[model samples]
Target chain A: MSRHARDDNVPLNADATSSRDLALEVENLRTVFHTEHEQIHAVDGISFNIRRGETVGLVGESGSGKSVTARSILGLIESPGEIDPASAIRFEGDNITEYTESEYESIRGDGIAMVFQDPLSTLNPVYTVGNQIKEALSLHQDLRGTAATERAIELLEEVGIPDAARRVTEYPHQFSGGMRQRAVIAMALACAPEVLICDEPTTALDVTIQAQIIDLLMDIQAERDLSILFITHDMGVIAEVADRVNVMYAGEIVESAPVEPLFAEPKHPYTRGLLRSIPSTQTSGDRLETIKGEVPTPNEPASSCRFAPRCPKSFEECSEVAPIPTAVGDDPDHDAACLLYPESMTTDEAVAHHRPADDGGEQ
Target chain B: MGRWEYFLKRVLLMVPIVFLGTTVTFLILRVGPIDPAAAIIGPSGDTEAYAAIRDSLGLDQPLWIQYAEFMRDLLTLQLGESWVVVRGQSVWELVGVYGPRTLWLGFWSILIPIFVGLPLGFYAGLNPNTLADYIASFGGIVWRAMPNFWLAVIFVSVLTQSDALFGFSWGDWLVETQIVTPPDLSGLWEPTQFLGALKAILPAALVLGSASMGNEMRIGRTAVLETKNANYVEMAKAKGVPGRLVVWKHMFRNALIPLVPVITGEAFLLLGGSVLVETVFAINGLGYLFFQATINGDVPLVGSLMFLFILLSVGINILQDFLYTVIDPRVGYDGGA
Candidate 1:
């Protein structure tokens, strides 16, 4: 029933030897948020897996539901916001959604944990830093008095907070933004959860700080053999850390493949556009080539494929019906949701003897 | 010169604002159309007797001359005498008799609310969307919407009925028909007791405290909620901090900083309205004196009492501004500019 418990009989490193083993399996997980006005399909049947000791980057533009998908995996979605019954988020062999209230108590922090964005507002202003960290340790593990205090200071030091002994007694407001984020990360790692979910942990920091955080996370992941569900919109961060990349658009995964292949061959028009959008030092100008149209709001459901309106290769069928994920050129793990693929195409395209306008037609 | 100059500028500005407010209150009282001279001498009294009373009270003078004399007397603090009492006494002397009751009531009422409301509000905020939060918010809303007078009436009725049910004596604490004159109190401790005297004050506190409690709890709950959403709270949570520490240590302090001014302002407002509470309870507080002077058409006394109220509110505002600077450090001490 536990997500992280090892099975002695089963062979480890079930997949590629370099990748440890499967840590979390999210199969067709759909999260629907019921707002006052309408039903928002925040995560539309998204599926992915994070291997042990490996980072899987859920990369997409903001509002593509990357953060919502990460939160849903941890059962952190606020109620009245409906999460679909069809979704199965299995950590190890145990299904997370099936866990009763009491069972979830053990799992929420110890089994899996999350580090949120915005370091500035992450800590409560009134509490001493030492008391806060000490409380976290006590919540997931049993430590009291001097033991808790000592552990709290050690955690602070682990997160690169300077003067750990004295700073532990300081307040959140007294810490810099980078230090606050580190403190937050320290809290998430308190119980050494099997899987750690980080949502744009570096997006709020300066570039140097961002690099430092990325390095720290990577170092910690290696040290603990922790599976990380790294959620970010930055392609650069994905290239730096992720072994597998899932490109999401309009609350659905448009493409998922090994990091190398996904970036090299891309396949989906949306994925290609995202790659192009990544700004490099060479691509310097005020005009960064964006993935044209904005991501659709959840309030308004898309007509066909959620990304079709924004896709340069959009066709008649793209407007009328949604495209389901299909294999992109016989690769099992690599899937693309697009009308251009023959298996998932509209009748209008077949009659026209049409291929997806193959060339990047001058726009 | 610079500091004094700034202080003088503010004081000068306060003059017109306070004067205009007092004049409006005075005119409204005068325009009620129940002639003071007629009321004073009575319908059965001879015309000459009424004329003589009018002359002595200066009611026979022209409106401009009367207004001028009233303003002049107000500045000098010579509030003059109350006209409603059988043997009319000085307004200050009347206030001296009843002022402590109102002050005592206001103090207790404000204190009880702070003691009870804040902790309830803090707990409710910490447990957001839970039954506790719902109960606190709903209960607060109901109490806040209830008029203080209505609450007072309800409490009195309940206490009376409960006493009847038990065949026990429920004291007539709210409406004390017998009035006691103020005693001389030069002793330091005597001042404290005089300030905290129960007879005039208890009912006042009950009325004001209950109302302020409901409002303060709601404010406290909101401040806590806003603080709970801060990044530091999540940081604490990430550290595996227990729920109590997260709430009390991190969220509670920042949340409380913003509430200091609001609590202070409400305290002063309660003090200002203690007069009304005292009147309802039948206590001869300053409110009773103010009421008597107005009823008897003692314009000078009314004007002076109004000045005291204005002074109290302004003083509280200045204190609140200074306290706000000390508590949050974001606000400037100089009038929060």
Candidate 2:
């Protein structure tokens, strides 16, 4: 991974660098699925941004709208599932929330690409891996025939597939789970997308293979300066690749901070519970801690903080009032939605309270 | 097993199926109350003539011996001469005279549905719950519900009769233009005669095709609908492939994998439907011959035709199995014992 990182210093494309440093800005995005019985709020007013060359992680349990947010950003959600009119997904500076199907097609592979979970299912079994990559290149780059084939082979080699020239002709089932994931990543990177959204890209891989994939992604990001929105439920994975992390619960982001500070000083009760549940070397053979209750169903109307029912630090007001974003500690960038932080707590007061200072020492 | 090896195994498997079908058909026809000697001798009150005819025809032999003789004749491909129906003509000769017409009718029946119903079904699947979907669904149901014989009768009376209820006839125009010459038994094998016969049978083909088309369309629609939701299809869309390519190249190909058996099964289905169709149109086809042979107790002709039908069905099914490996790469025959 380190060896490949130093050799490729050439910029991916002029358009990728010419755009503003902000790769994506999703503001108040809401996605809802209207079924016969009820409307499911899959993503509820979530806001985040991915800066150019930065990897931002979105972490949440299953059904917490992490995947939904990624799909909504790409405009991949279809009928019965809709992005609300008020939602705004600005890619590079253009608001694309209302883009038509044809308009989305032009921007999808070229401007932004996605790598999904279950690589075997994600790839068409009937097609060769190389052919699938060539298709992506032809669609977005207009590189056809041998030119496309050569580029496809290059991508396969770059993704660490050995004997790529021969393997390109083999179908998806001919490849192992890890190799198929690598092929999927190669296809995602075929058009040199400005922003790559990886939705649990390594979830289906073995632990060792998961580390390899993450290392590959990191090396690729360093060489190409690609912005990635990495979505995963595993905090350990998020710690590996994410510069910044957003913790989501019940279709909303409850905490946002830099990786080190977030892990060192988790301010939200739910975030604290998640951190405590992670097994540590010090706590070997000890019973792991767990949050008291399940994540609430998204269809239910929330009168107050969605996590209040499961939070151990809940007070009388926790159930009555919704918590807004409040700065935690001296770092104004670190914010958590909880009632503990007073409205008027400046940097001096936050330091005086020094709750994270105590937690930081133990880490 | 390799592809060729698997194919060979499938081919070998058909031998037993055809053999069993022949055995069952022979036994059923022989053991049934319909006696060929009685039918040939008639009700003339001549017991001696009946006995003599029965003995000469080998009907006097025990059941096992007669079965052995039938099997031997079948192995030698010498189907005996038809008795009591089309008497004196060998069963093979009768099949040679009528087989092509039925095949021609069945081909058109299957082809029309593939060209028309498949696309309609695909379009319907693409736009589920829309007005077009509802229309296709309703139309398919109506066509399938109408019996082929009734449809054939209605078409002949309305389209072929000179003084038809509609007061105009496509059949008359077809006849007058020489596009549909009356069935000429002698020139039936000639290309010109074949085309003329096809034109004459177009109305019957339309009726037969429409009935089967409903089933084809429904199967195709269901397959497409299920395939559209497959993970690979979603992945293709996410890869930024254009919607048209996604639907046609990815979704349609995957959908067609499940439709292979249905497509092959239609061959036998169309053959079955041809019986009523040939009778209504007065075409000299295998189905019509089988019907006449059954009515006249022509055991040899009937049994041979039944065996042919079984062979064709088993052959088609083997072909369908081979196509399965072709369409879906994940399914392989190499690992099987």
Candidate 3:
């Protein structure tokens, strides 16, 4: 790789060493979509960071703004997608907001790459896998026909494609579901980006294929020291691979903590509900506990805490004002937007008073 | 039976239908309010003179007898003479004379529409939201809305004043005939009259071309747009495929497959519409003959023209099916084909 000059135009602070070590830092990012009727704040002031050589999973149910947050970081949102001025997506110490579309192209596949959910739709039907991969390689690397093709074959092999030489020549449709996804991964890995955004990449695959893909991604991440922002609704998958977890609800990150701490004691009621809802043999009830109500659409601006309506531990204080980030315990890293803490609790402790009775009744 | 077998059986069944179409045409012409024998009686015939002429011309015969005689003559390709217009010209000879001109005009005119319209539509589809799509779409609507007669008048008026259109000017019709004749069939490159015939080809082709091309462009735009939004296209975009390759290879090839039937239908439409176009342009093509027949109340000529169109329609439909099978293998004769 060439020792290319870093863009001088990026806003920087020499003393702000904290942001430099991170591959991507999204600071209070909010994305709103303007429709004919109203403005929807899909990603409402969600903040997270992915460091080099780490995998961070954003877990949420449908309409959780998990995908929107990832797309916003990549600048993939089209017209009507309104990002607030306050939000800053700092990629490798460079605020991405400073780059125009043409300049954004430099960071898109090179600085940070993204792999979409559907593998079948991700590869152009007309071009061979080799051609598609080679095109991306050539874009970031200056290589001609044969050299680019050789590199493409190497990528296919790296992604564990059998008969990579011959399979590279085949079009996307000819490949099975698993192989197409492997091919997509191969394309994403071709440029050797600093960070990779996998948006539910394994969600479309079967159980066996999903395991293979997850393993492939892990292997690639180890080899490249790549930071990955993995987005999925599956907590089990998060438990399997993620070092850190960000739990989002209705377009806002409700709780974020280290994986072990989050799995041990979920701070937010919404997070507890989500973890309980995951189907498992040990939780041998006829019905799994579900988070009540649907995720609110952006059309209706969320007031107070967005998840307050669905939170089982909601009290009158929950609806009075919007929840702010409050430490659940002494650990500064472990935080949630809930009034569960004693000093933070304002007004009648109606829900907390019912807690002991609820526990006894359940037993 | 499979679709092909069923289709073949249906087509075979249409042989009788075609024969019926001809028979009905003959009967309708016979029952028309004009007298066929009036011209034969020298236009000064008394009632008794008309009766003698009718007897000789077989007009006095019973309806069944006349039908039987007509059937025999049709089978033998010996159509009887027209009573008016070409007073002594055998219907077969007259058809032989006029059919070639009409067929030639129809063939070229249809080709003009397909070649111009499809590409224009494709370009428009590729560049949606750009000036190209807007211009092509607007042009398509304008041409489609204009009547063939109105188009013909404008084309003639413009061509006559300019004396040239796209580097070709109106020439005498003698060139096509000389080229088709025996001595010239030996491959002498007769460029003079051929170029001249091609000159007026513009107006006829333009009128037919505008109508069919406009319709084809609209369909092409839709196909291209739908294809552009296909999942594979998104993949291609992510894969960093250039815009041109994405449009041409990914979207275009797939999109064009669905348009095979529409293109074939346009061919037939242009061919039929050319008749009106030719009359309006004052081109001495088969359309002129049909127009003259209608104006002069030449029922036999009019009936034959309508019958010829039915045959053309059936032939074009068959060609369309064949093209569809060729374009898409998934569309089989048995089911989706």
**Top-scoring candidate (TM-score):** 2
Docking class of 3: incorrect
Q: TM-scores of all models?
A: 0.69, 0.87, 0.71
Candidate number 2, chain A TM-score? 0.88
TM-scores of chain A, one for each prediction? 0.86, 0.88, 0.88
Least well predicted 10-residue stretch by lDDT in candidate 2 chain B:
B174-183
DockQ of each: 0.23, 0.49, 0.20
TM-score of chain B of each: 0.76, 0.88, 0.80
What does candidate 1's lDDT look like per residue over A1-363, in tens digits?
111111111222234442226688787777788878888877776777787888998988889999888767766566766667656788867888776545655676678888888877776554566766666677777787899999988998888888899988776667888998898888787766999999999999999999999999998999999999889988889989898888888788878877888887888899888888877822667877777779987665444678777889877767765655556654456767676764444555432322222322111
Model 3 C-alpha lDDT per residue in residues A30-93, reported as the tens digit of each score: 7899988898889877777787789999999888898888878877666678777767789866
* Candidate 2 C-alpha error for residue B337, in Å: 17
The Cα error of candidate 2 at residue A39, in Å, is: 3.2
DockQ ranking, high to low: 2, 1, 3
lDDT of 1 by residue, B1-337 (tens): 2334544555566767777876776676566675677766666989888889889877777877877777677767787775555346777776676666566656678787888888888878777789988998888777778787776666556655655776653444343322223222334276454433454345446667776778788889889888766656654554444556556666776887878876787777444565555556666666777777667766556667887777677666656655554445333224310
Query: Candidate 3's residue-wise lDDT over B220-272, tens digit each?
Result: 89899888778667545544445566677678877877687777776675345
Judged by DockQ cut-offs, is candidate 2 incorrect, acceptable, medium or high?
Answer: medium
Model 1 TM-score is: 0.69
Sorted by lDDT, highest first, which candidate order results? Answer: 2, 3, 1
Residue range with the least summed lDDT across 10 consecutive positions in model 1 chain B: B176-185
C-alpha lDDT of residue A9 in model 3: 14
Residue B197's lDDT within candidate 2 is: 67
